[model samples]
Target: MSASASEGPVECGGDEFKTDKNLRTSLSGLPSKIVAGSGFHGFKLNVKNTGDRAYQRVDFGVFAAQVDEEDYFIDTSHLTLQYKDPASGTWKAISLDETDEGAGYLGYTDVKAHESFSIDLRLAVDKSAPAGLGYAISIGMYADDEGNCVFSGDGSYYEFDILKAGTAPGDPGNAKPQGGKKPLPQHQPAGNTKIEPQGHLAQTGSSSALPAIALAGGAAVALGAGAVFVVRRRRNADSGTAA
Candidate 1:
């Protein structure tokens, strides 16, 4: 086999997934399907280190991109992250925006040479989500081995499109394969929406001590209502003073 046919990139590496076929198939069981109202196990981001350098930490995040921006949206408060503990072989919460003070990223996971780290994502589509409603997952990888040497641009954060309820995990058409970035029109967003990434920005609290901006349910309502309240108060004062 030619060197070209071997594998990808020579340095810090990445993959769509490293899961076994049987396991992938089994993950499609009734229990693992992307159902509404609950956060169940979803896909995993597998990062492999083929390079000789050891990364003190491998930072990554699974952000949402909308393929079907219908009536419902993902309840991000319900979205969470988990990393597999190599020691006990268990999944632990690395809850992104729920970190100390308010919002931040868990950049403590490390990847050593020839080793790999798996970040498990737990997600839920909103209730009453349309059947065709879909969203893609985008990933960002950065390696700061205490020395802050190199990084991977990003991979397939926009390739996935998971259908809403009634779709079984075992179904072939249930979800798009994990990572595959395609060309999407500039004006026509294939899976881009208001939802933003939930990771630490430059190792600071989401935005340098500022609260994370949330546009989830009722945000717009609050803004409009506040305007109405101010207008009404001014009108009342004017009416009282009028002769």
Candidate 2:
């Protein structure tokens, strides 16, 4: 979406327009903590239209304020905002218009009925940003460039922290072994013995000599039985001849 520079200052009918219940907005993918002076962090803002009619010339803006003190606006001059262009699939800078209501407005086109759209946003917190908690960003949506209508419910706020330089959560140096215990040693093979591969016959504990021995035993038994049978037959024949 492109900014409407030619259009004069946007008047969002501050506090006069009722909150539109048909629209819903949400913010996600924001990191809970960020390092000051780091590169830009990416997040997403989504808007859904539950109403039957399409919203034309819709606009949304970003503003930051300290928690518990909404009236005291934080200086976001060091912050840079960029939105990904859906058509080109490339990131483009969004023009921030300083409004009288202390919010920076970015122009958007329309939200069709029963349709939802998402904007991928990248925010850079410069090194000048104070490292602490209680920092929050609010998004506001307005209908029509003339600002006749404002969508109150179609906005949300998210809170995050700015960390000091070279500091991050869950540092490895700060980690301690659990329950004061040492890790178990890894398994290793014993001593410098070389392992040789065995053949399939050796694996089964069988050898060629085993089958040969069995066959020789069987043949010897058969030969002894045949000799006894032949001797008995000759003895019967000789007895018959003598009779």
Global lDDT of each model?
0.32, 0.42
Tens digit per residue, CA lDDT, model 2, 1-243:
311112333332223553566766655676667677888878766667777866433445443322212223334456566766555567766433232321233334445567666767777777776665323332334433343434436333455666766676443221111111111111111111111111101112212111100011111212222233334445767788520
Off by over 4 Å in 2: 1-14, 65-73, 95-103, 134-147, 171-243
Q: How do the residues 1-243 of candidate 1 rate in per-residue lDDT, one tens digit apiece?
A: 000111211122232312111111101111223554445545655555555554333333333322223323332343344545444456555432411221212233334445544545445555555443233332322322222113243223222234455655454333443332222110100111111122312222222222121111112212222233334445767799521
Best by TM-score: 2
Clash count, candidate 2: 0
RMSD, candidate 1, Å: 17.7
Error of 1 at 159 (Å): 4.5
Steric clash pairs (candidate 1):
56-145, 66-191, 137-157, 138-157
Tell me the alpha-carbon RMSD of every candidate: 17.7, 42.8
